[model samples]
Target: MNKLTPPTRLTGWGRATASGASVLPVSRGNIADAVVGAPERGALVRGLGRSYGDAAQNAGGLILRLAGLAGDAVLDTVQHTVTVGAGVSIDDLLRVTVPQGYFVPVTPGTRFVTIGGAIASDIHGKNHHGEGSFGNHVRRISLLLADGTTLEISPSQHTELFWATIGGMGLTGAIVDATISMLPIETSRCIVDTTRAHDLEHILTLMEEGDDRYRYSVAWIDLMAKGRHLGRSVLTRGDHATVEQLTGSATSSPRHYDPRVVASVPPVVPVSLINNLSVRAFNEFWFRKAPLYRTDEIHSLAGFFHPLDMVGSWNRIYGPRGFVQYQFLVPFGQEDALRHIVERFAASGAASFLAVLKRFGAGNAAPLSFPAPGWTLALDIPASFSGLGEILHELDHTVLDAGGRHYLAKDSHTTPQAISRGYPRLAEWQDVRNRSDPTGVWRSDLGRRLGLIA
Candidate 1:
C-alpha cells in the first residue's frame, strides 16, 4: 500500500471552487483497508476528476484516488463485452477496443473520463438518442460498501442498489470495476452529415425531423446571436463509417484508432481574453465556417465525438476563475421553454463559446440521471462574468418549471429545492442508499451540499 499524500487542494474540472483533502491512492486489494480506516470526514472515490462540479470532492475527508486500481481490460469478443478497472479511462479502453472492431456503447464528449466516473454520473453522449446513457450498457459493477464489504451487483441481483449506484454520484460506494457491453464497428471513422440552421426553430425542427436517421447527432448553437439570428446553429450528425466507405490506406486499416492533443492552453490567461466581444466574434466565425449542407464526410472517431479532447488542458483558457458548464434538459414538449432559456442567455451577454444542443431519448431508471426524452443544452460560461450566478439560478427555475432537470456532473450552484423538484425519484434513491450505507461512510462535497446522503 502506498502512503497517503498530505492534504492537498483539489478542484473539479471547472476549477472554480477548491477544497483540501488527504488523498489516498488505493488498489483493489487495499481499498477495503483504506475505507475501514477512513477519518471522521468519511471517504469518497475519485476518478479522472472530469466532473465540472464538486461531485467528486470531499473536503477534509479521505479522497480515494482510484487510478492506482487500474488493471488490464478483459475483452470477451464472443459476447461483445469488456470488464475494465474502475480507473481505466474511456480513452485507454478505446485504444485497445477500437482496433478489435469494438467501441464503448456510450461515450461522453471527452474520452478522458474513467469507467467509475461514467457509471457514477450515468454519462450521456450524442448517440444517446439511439443507445441511451452509459448505465444502459453496464452489465455488472463491483462495488465496495461502507461496511468494507465488496459486492457484485447487477440489474437482476441487488437491483435497487445497482440502479441507485448508476447515477448515485459515487455516494453509493467506491466502484471497483465494471463489465460493459461494447458496440461493434467496421471502422474507426464516422460517416457524418452537416447542416446549418438559421434559427432556433429551424434547428429544432431539423433535429426533430431527421435526428432519428443518424446514430449520433448534436448542434453547436451561437448563444451570442440575438434577434433574427438567435440560436443559429451548426448541426453535425453521423455514425461509424463502414468498411466500404473507407478508401486507400484507411480501407486496409479500417480499425485504426489514434487520438492526439494538438495543443495545450497556457497555465494562466487574462479573463478578458474570453469576454463577450471576443466570444461573439468567435461564434460568428465558427457558424460561418460550417458548410450550409454537407453529406457523407468521413471523420475520425476522436474528431467526431471528442473534438475538445484534441486540445489538452483547454479549460485553462477560461483563466484563473475558470468557467461553469450549465447543462439542463427539458422534455420534448417544452420547446418554448428551451427557446426562452436560449433567448435569456443571448440577452444576458454571457460569454459562452461552447454552446451545444442535443436530443435525448427515453431515460433509464437512475434516479439522479440527467437525460430524459427531451431537448438538452450545455453552455460553457466564464465564471468571472458578473451576475452569472443569478442568470443560471433563473434558468434553473425555468427548467424545473418545464419538467426538466440539470446535470449534476456540471452543476455547482443549483439549489437543493431545484434538485428535489427535478428528480422525483429522489426518495426511492435515498431509501436504497440509506439501507446500503446506514453509517454514511460514502460521502462527497456534492452529497453533503445537496443532502444526498443522510
Candidate 2:
C-alpha cells in the first residue's frame, strides 16, 4: 500500500459548488501515497494549477502533485548549470540565481510556474528566436516512472523517453529532477527597447527584420484593436545590462513592485478571474498605452521577464468562470493559414487581455514536442466564450494544415484527430509512452480529451 492515501478536500483552485475537480488537499509527506497504490491503468500528474487548461486536470484519475514532492535548486556557477527538484518555482530559482548573475535559459510569461511546470510546458521565452524551447537547454532529466524507479534520461540516454517527456505534457512519467543550463548575465537589469506595430504585417516584419539583434523580445498584441489597426502590437526587446548601466539599483536582480506596498491591502484574498466588463477595460488600456512603432528604454528583469508576477493574485482578475490561454504554433510555410486564423478572430471580436506572437527556431526530437520552426501565437480568452470549443476546433484544423501543433501544456480543448493530424510522430510518442507507462497509468483531462489513452 506504500502507506499512502488521497486528501479529503480540494483547495485554492476553485471554490465552486459545481466544480467537478475533487482533488483532496494532500500534504508533502503523504503525496507519494496519493499515487502509490494506483493499480488503475490510468493516472495523471499535476503540479500547480498554473497550467491554463485541462492539461493539469484529470477528471477522475490519480494526480501526483509534483510541486508537493520537493523543492531544491542547486546552481553550479562553475558548470553553468542548475540541478533542480521538479517542485522548485521559477520565482524561487530567479531569487537565488540573480545574485550569481545567471538566469533561466527559457521562461514563460509569468514566474509563478514551477520548474516541473516549465518542463511539462517545455516553455519558450522571448529569445526563442535565438534560443529554442527550454527543452533544448536541458542537459538531462530524472524521471520517476509508474513502476517506481528513476531513469536518467537525455538525448543519448533513453532518447525516446527524453524527447517524449519534454513536451509530452506529463503523459510520459513523473519528472523528479532535471539539469538545465543557466544563462550568464552581466547584470540582472535589462536595457529594454520598446517598439510598436500598427498592424499584423508590421509586427511580422519587425520580428523578421531585427529579432536576432536582441537577447530577448516579446510583443503585446491588441486583440480588440480592429480595422486599420488589427493585430496592433508593442514590441519590447532587451539585453542584460552591464554594471555601468545600472543607475542606482546596483544590486544584480532589480525588482518591479510599486503595487506590492498595497499588496497587503488585498493580502490573503482569493481573487476571482472570470468577468466581462473588467477584461474589456483591461484589454483596452493595455492596447492604448503603447507607442505606435516607437521605442523606449526600460529596466528590472522582473518586469522584463515576467510582468504578470507584479500582482500577486492577478489570475483572480479573470473572475469565476475562469479563463483559458490558447497558445498554438503555425510554421513559416503556413503564414497564410495562420493569418486567416488571426483574421477570423479579428472579425469575431474574441477580445483577449494577453496576446503574444513569437517565432520559434527549432524543435526537440521529442515525438510530441510543441515547438517546430514556426510562428506561435498565444491569447487569453474567457473560458465562458460560448463558442470556445468550436473556435478552438477550427484553430486546431488550421494548425494541422500549417504542419504545426499545439503545446499540450496550454491545451485542454484539442481533439485526438487533430493531434494525430498535427504531429506526424504521434505514433512514436505512443510507443514510447506505452513502453514507459504501460497500462496507461497516467491520464489527464487533456489525455482523455485527445484520447492519449485508448
- The candidate that wins on TM-score is 1
Q: Which runs of model 2 end up more than 4 angstroms from their true locations? A: 2-36, 39-41, 67-71, 249-281, 292-296
What's the alpha carbon RMSD for model 1? 1.5
Instruction: Evaluate residue 319 in candidate 1 and report its C-alpha lDDT on the 0 to 100 scale.
Output: 85
TM-score of 2: 0.88
**Every model's Cα RMSD, please?**
1.5, 3.6
Model 1 misplaced regions, further than 4 Å? 1-5, 68-71, 270-272
lDDT of each residue in 1-454, candidate 2, tens digit only = 3332443233223222121343534443444455556645345666766776667766545556655322357888899999987777777777777777788898888777777778877888888888888888899998877775668999889888999898888888777779999998877677888887888999889988898888788878877667888788888888887766767545544432222212412433344444455656876777677655544365777768777667665655655665677788888878887677777777666657678888788777777778888899988776667787788888788778778787776765677887787778888888888998876767766677787666
| Per-residue lDDT of candidate 1, residues 163-239 (tens digit) | 99999999889999999999999999999999999999999999999999999999999999999999999999999
lDDT, candidate 1, equals 0.91
TM-score of each: 0.98, 0.88
Q: lDDT (0-100) at residue 221 of candidate 2?
A: 82
Ten-residue segment with the worst summed lDDT in candidate 1?
Answer: 65-74
